[model samples]
Every structure is written in C-alpha cells, then in structure tokens.
Target: MSTAGQEEPDLRSIYHASGPWTGQTLYVAAHLGLADLLDDDPRGIGDIAKATASDEDALYRFCRALTALGMLAEHPGRSFTLRQAGRALRRDAADGFRDGVLLQSGAVFRAWADVLHTVRTGRPAFDHALGMDYFEFLAANPEEARVFNRAMGATMPAAIAALEHYAFGTCATVVDVGGGDGRLLASVLSRHPGMHGVLQDLPGTVSQAGENLSGVADRCTLVGESFFDAVATGGDVYILSRVLHDWDDDNAGRILRRVREAMPAHGRLILVESVLRPADGDLRSVLGDLLMLVVLGGRERTESEWAELLESAGFTMRQVWDDPGLATTRGHSVIEAVARAEADRPDTAHSSPPKAA
Candidate 1:
C-alpha cells in the first residue's frame, strides 16, 4: 500500500512539540492586549509596541511569530492584522477566551509546571508551588482573584444553555451554592422571571456579586457563607456549578450532605459539571480532571461515579442533560438529582466532620 513518490512522514519532528511555546506566546499577546489593539485595523509593530510599552524589535518579532501561527496576517510592511483566531483573543468579543487565557497562562501555568509533584504525592501542585492552597492564594492576591472570577464568569453561557434545556419545574426559589459573583444565578433569575434566587459564596465574592446582581437585587439574596457550614434552606432547587470539582470525594460529599440536610424532601440538586465519559477519549474533560488534580486535589467524575456520589449524599439521580455543542469547550452537563425519600436516606453517622477554612 505504498504511495508513489511519497516519502515516510518524519516522526522525529513530532518530538519537537511547540504547544507550550505557542501557548506562552498567545498568553503574552493576550496579557498585552495585542489582539484587542488589532481588532479594528492593522498596525505596524512600532505603534503596537508604543501602545503596549514593549521594545519595538521584540514586539515586531512577536508579531511575526503570531503571523506565522496564523493568528495575525502580515502586511507588505511590518504591520499585522488580526486573523479569525486572533479575533477570539479580543477582550470585547462576546465569545472571547481572553480572561481564560490570562488565568491559565498565569498562576495555573506556573502550578502546572510542577504537576509531577502532584502525581507523585497525590496532592495539589498549587500548594507545593505557592506554599498555600489555591483559594487561600487567591484571597491573599485580590487582583489574581478578580481575573479568576472573570474566567469563571466567561463560562457561564454554557451553564446557561444547559439550564435552558432542563425544566426548573415548580422551583420557586433557586439557590446557587458556591456561585461566584452570581453570574450563573443571575442568568437563571433573568431567564425565569417568577423565580427568586440565592447566590452563596465567600464574603468577598458575595460582596462583588452584589454589584453584578444588582438588577435582580429585589428578588435575589446574597449569602456570604461557606457551603461546608450551611446553605440557605428552603430553596426548591439547589445548584452546584463547577463547585464539587474543587474538592476530593470526602469534602465533596460533605458539601453535598450539607445541601441535603438543608434541602426539603421534595427539593432537587443540579450539578453543573463536565461528566467524564467511560471510554476516556474526551480530551477536554480529561484535561479538566488533571487540572483539578493539580490545582485542587479533585477530579471529574463519570456518570456512574456521579450517581454513586449522589446516592451517598441522600439524593437519587433523576436525569443527566448535556449540551453536546459545548462539550468541546466547556464540557458542561446538568446532572439532576432529587432528595431520597425519608425512609431511604443514607446514614451519616460515620461521615467526616466539616473542616474550617
């Protein structure tokens, strides 16, 4: 089956992978607002450098590299225009990955550089790298926390779309547990005008959420508390969006138990997360699982694993709705579960006690 006049592909070239370099380059551009500047028109490297306060020749080389990568198109002179891929880096673009890029290329990138430590010790690399847990690190550095919050908010659309497909049936009050800045809860409140909402997070995040959710202030209650301690009870629906993935099974189960204790018998729990596939070919979810391991000592779950988790927390799995379109980017799915009957509730006598942060 040999092809005529065709030589064998060079396997050696594959060893010289450039993904990290490309990512770092894109991160530099994103951090410097390079794509944002070129959004309207092409600009010469000198002007771009002036705007970004970078060395002209260095900036020129960067632009040339970006052009080679198809992110920018080089003009006859030393000018460059944004290509289609580059447009996605624009800060103003609705579907922009700018904030996500910045976050990944910053702290996360540094933490991941030492991910082998996590692999060896079964602990988070972030703690090893920064001498503190991820959340604590974020708390100490407010600016980085702001960027992280924005990165989380950017993925809200996927959660919103998943919510649209599910029936929030008879849910008068919806509570978003661990909702940062109230973006997801706000979207839910806006979509269902009749539904009142509760946005719960840390004190700082809840305060910031107040501003983002001001329009629905009359209907939404902002709670600054730990879900590990308690959540506002009596909500017909409770949402844990991208929350459980930040903790190991023990802590995740503890958080779920708190929600269960607060939830009425008729209440439901909606877990918005990337459910891992049994076949293990899903690159996004796999990456996310690894990220959880490296950054938070957590991991993504499979459908069966989710079911088991829910059962242990006194909830019965009802349905799992996934948005296939968002699977590649956000890998979002809404796993709907309801409280088990009083007689069927699991015994929690041996469950680990909650730890104080």
Candidate 2:
C-alpha cells in the first residue's frame, strides 16, 4: 500500500481525464464558437450562456473547467476571458487547428469509433462506419469535403520541407499524383520559376485546385482523374505526397506501378512520406500510423519497408532525406527514387496489379 511511486497510474482514470471527456468538451466549445464569442471581450456567464442558449449554471461550470484547462481565464463575477490557447480556436486563425479538430470530431470520430472493426479484420473501419469509401464520402459531402481539404492544407508543411530537404535537380516538369487542392504543387512551381506542374486527383479536388493555383495557373495543369486508373505522363519528376499511406500495400503498389508506367526513362519519384523507425518511433508518427489503419487500412512504413515497396513497384529508392524539423509535418522526409530498368525489375513485379484503388 505504501509503494506509491511504484503503483501504476489507473488506466480508467487517465482515460476519463484525458480521452473522450476532455476531447469532446473542447470540440463542443469549438462547435459552439465559444472562442470567437470571447474574442472581442470577456463576458459574464449569463451573457455567454444567453448567446449560446446554454443553461447558465451548466455553462458557468463548463467555462470554469475550460479555465482550469488554460483555454480560458476565470474572472470576477463569473465572467470568462479567452486565453491564448483559446484564441487559436478562433474560426479565422490562419494557423488554427479548428478544422482538424472539427474533422476529428465528425466523420473521423464516427469511423474511429469502429476501430475495433479495423483491428479485428485488418481493414479500414471507415467504409463500414460511413457506408462508402472515405474519398467517395468526401465527394458527396461538400461542406465536409471543404473541412477535409482545409485540414489537410495544414499539413502542406511537407511541401516546404520537401523543397528545402531535397533538390529537384533542374527538373523540367513535375507531376503531383494525388495532390490535394494543388497547394503543394503551387509551392513547388513558385520555388522553381521555369518548372511546370501537373496536379492530378479526383475531379472534385481538381476543381478546387484550379482556384488555389491561380498564382501559378499558367505553369500548372490541373487534371481530374483517379490515380489508380492512370497518371498523367511525360514529366521529369512525379510527387506522391501524403498519398501512399491511404491504402494497403497492394493498392499502393498499383498507384506506384501506374506512375512507373507513365514514367519516362529518366523520370524521378519524390515521395513526401513519413519514414518510421522500426522501434521507438515518436508518438506523432505512430499515432498517425494508427490513424491510417482506422481510416484507410494503410500503414506508415520504416525506411526499409519503403525501399522494398519501391523496388517491388519497378523503382529503386535513391535516398531518404530525413528532416528533423519536419517531425510535425505531414511526412518527415522526401524519399527520392528513380525508375528501375525494366530488365532489372523483379519478374514477379510485373504480375497482375491490384484491382482496388
């Protein structure tokens, strides 16, 4: 009984304290626009409660908890002040995490709720929870699609990180496979004045991409099509950023081989993806790895696994540029690769490709 420091922390207590309860409280506050409401001036609980139509006593207690969490500051006469952390939740904050939070609470929440299904069957739970493919669901729901796009745009640090970490080596044309909203490609084109880019994704995504690429539109070609079916051809380099980890290896192989087929003899591949450590990986990488499993039935791979995948797809990995500062970005490295000579590819690699996208 006296082994206080040796006693393990109570898992259930930790779960109640930090898991669903805390997460949902913050989500509800964000959904209710509490941050924006408090942005102009601190307000009494009565006024805030009236604005949100929440019970006065209940809202006061909620704000109190938020104050304790450092998202708000409790003030005299039951008033509350928004804290710096709370300011980030404002709808218009450029670097806000609001969209990602809302997404995690909405469709992602629904899908992750069935993660047991994913773990048991070794398949994504998203399809079962949403009654369709994840991308298809996004296509049908415009509002949600916008949120997903914005949420993903936050991860475009990978684009900047890629450019700094790897040299394009005087490439002429760059094709972005599964590029979302064209933000990443736009960044690339802006960096290389002479380079042209091809942005390919679902038809809906391509439409959104056009507007985002206005600055570089003259140098960018927006193509709307599924990467699994075909990729646009005749580029010096192909970029697969935040794409591969969305599906199982078989489907990923299909995408890679499609790129291989489209690739010219001297083409290069730039994979902006996380390179996981076989053991002792960081929490962000591993949590994202789990997110892939629950939502897409994909996986984050170690460097060796990445090399193996590339080799099997008729390409060979050249170098993996690990950027320590990019730990928080979409992917930690830009994996450079080149098309393997057809004669050098494994005989088994040319067999029937994956039917799934």
How would you encode candidate 1's per-residue C-alpha lDDT over 176-211 as one tens digit per residue? 999988878888888789999998888877998877
For model 2, residues 86-185, the per-residue Cα lDDT tens digits are 8877888877887787877778888878889998998889988989878788889988888888888876875655555346766899999999888888
Worst 10 residues of 1 by lDDT: 348-357
Which segments of model 1 are wrong by more than 4 Å?
A: 1-18, 278-280, 326-329, 342-357
Query: On a 0 to 1 TM-score scale, where does candidate 1 land against the true structure?
Result: 0.88
lDDT: worst 10-residue window of model 2:
348-357
The candidate maximizing lDDT is 1
Predictions: Cα RMSD each: 6.8, 6.4
Write down the TM-score for model 2.
Answer: 0.87
